[model samples]
Target: MTPAQIIQAIEGMEPAMQRAYLEQVKTVVGAATVAEVERLIADEDEDGLVALLSLGALSVFLELARSVFIAGARFEVKAISIPRDLGRFEFDARQPAAEQWVSAKAEEIRANATIDVRAAVREVMGRRRRAVVWPAAQQVQVSATPMVRTPRQSALDLLGRVSAQTGSRSGGVIGLPGNYAQYVLNARAQLLGGNPDEMRKYLQRKRRDRRFDGIVNRAIKAGTPVAQADVDKIAGRYADRLMKTYAEMLSKAEALESFGAGRDQVYEQLIAQGLDRDSVTKTWRDRGDKKVRHTHSVMGGQEVQKDQPFQSPAGALLRYPGDTSLGAGWSERANCRCSAIYKIRRK
Candidate 1:
């Protein structure tokens, strides 16, 4: 049902049910409507019928789910890096050497150098009138073809200029012969979700998680003045809140393993809000199983307990669940490790 229809359903419930519905609305609907709904529900509920309105409350949840998803999805940022120095791209430019190469190659052709006398008729001569016979050298155009330089020569010229700008060969970092820009490209590509293929779906998810973690770390290091110990302390507190909230939230939606249609729509909305959205999505893709243990062992060596479901320093609002107006959502705004998620839509 539409949001308005959902609101109306809540409104029509008994007075006591209406108050309970308002509590649900604050958590699910948003801030702007909370006061209005509360006032309306309170005004109309002379007998507290609103408290018993379970169906109406559930409908509100299903409808408002999209909005929450949208807000959450928009919580992340994405970075796109471009390729440098496309192969053979330099050939397209109208540089003299490259252009001269074309002309020189054409001149090297023997037939082009030996012009035939008969072929060189004066403009005034009629088609049937043959021109005076002359040697091929005399008749041939005197224009000489320029020498075509070898590819090696062209490369050397390029290297010579580079060397001139930065001392001699030994002055450089590595004695690499190929394009060094590729390393930068590889690093950035690896950080972003690499090629969609090659790696199965799991690899893509892992790549995305790393990318997000990198972005988060970079942002935090740049802004926060806290030391590692301080940050850890902060994260610890937030994680405690996060674990509890997720436990409660998950329980509310039992057996719902995937994002349903409305939930998927909300996920897209949250992504647009500038959150580290892909991280959240990857989290779900990587670990949505209800039975999956949070902590695990690495090669059966050191046991790495899952600290908390969400990032600790980032998860502050688990204790302050309210409608969208209170900015409870923004509590996890910049550095919160909290993830916004939804059930995946199925066919």
Candidate 2:
């Protein structure tokens, strides 16, 4: 029979016969595809329990929920100020002790910072998973037994699976999704050793000022040779500033990663529930501010299939903002305020 004729013939069958025929089709297409087809068929059956289900409504609800979650889920890292007395050392540029002291202080800062950021990211991720998954589960209507409350351990295990790293750059660490954990770690390392150009410029300008000169002269006159105490004081001040800057950068990056991960998790669950990947589309939305990168600003409103990546003006391809999977560099991913909006097409 022709394809249309076969569909008509199947429709004419009694419900029991239709199910039996579905089983036969299942043997051919495999369980997953057949499951999806059954869901679509149920969606179209006006008298079927699935007719009461609304995937479109669920999509809308999830979209709104994710948007709100992304907007509100800002993880702030507290500024870590190195104590002045934390690593006091005698002034000697040639001494290894000076280097050791600096190294120790940086290690302490990194350890403390990592702990704070990780805890905050995990907490946000927990909330995000719940916000996306549970609601979708409740909305899904199936002929099988009603969805049971997943045991806490089971839920965590599932999340662990979902959060597994897909490749070198994608997935891993629940809320700090993708290469975000590594990104933050790298940033912290850089913050300690790399002299930021902005900081260098600020220091240069400060050194040219008369007030800075006076401070150095006073330190020398106070029996502190070569103004070692003054040097430490200046270093401490800038260290605090840089730490604050790093904290802000980390908070913003985590928010973006968490948002992307949460969105991906929700759609993944829907796909598992038989939603067709082809029926979904994701759109890029730039925050529409001067702070947005020029390349991303031009990408605003770009739409593509859910499985495809969006190409930025600079030729960076990303599954979503802050996505490093496609080789998007720090310039493209850092402090990105862009958002992904998903749409689902229902028959």
Cα lDDT tens digits, model 1, 1-347, are 23233223222322332233234423322222323333433344312222221113234332333232222222211111111221111112133432343233224211211221111111101211222222234233322332222333222211111234433311110111112212211222222222222112222332133323443344233432223232222322222233233323322221121112123323333334332443332122212234322321111122111211322233332211111212233233211111222222222
Model 2 misplaced regions, further than 4 Å: 1-226
Where is model 1 poorest over a 10-residue stretch in terms of lDDT?
116-125
Reference-based TM-score of each model: 0.17, 0.40
lDDT (Cα, tens digit) per residue for candidate 2, span 144-213: 2322223332222112222123311111122222233333322222222222332233334331333454
lDDT agreement with native, every candidate: 0.25, 0.41
Alpha-carbon runs more than 4 Å astray in model 1: 1-54, 57-59, 76-347
| Top-scoring candidate (lDDT) | 2
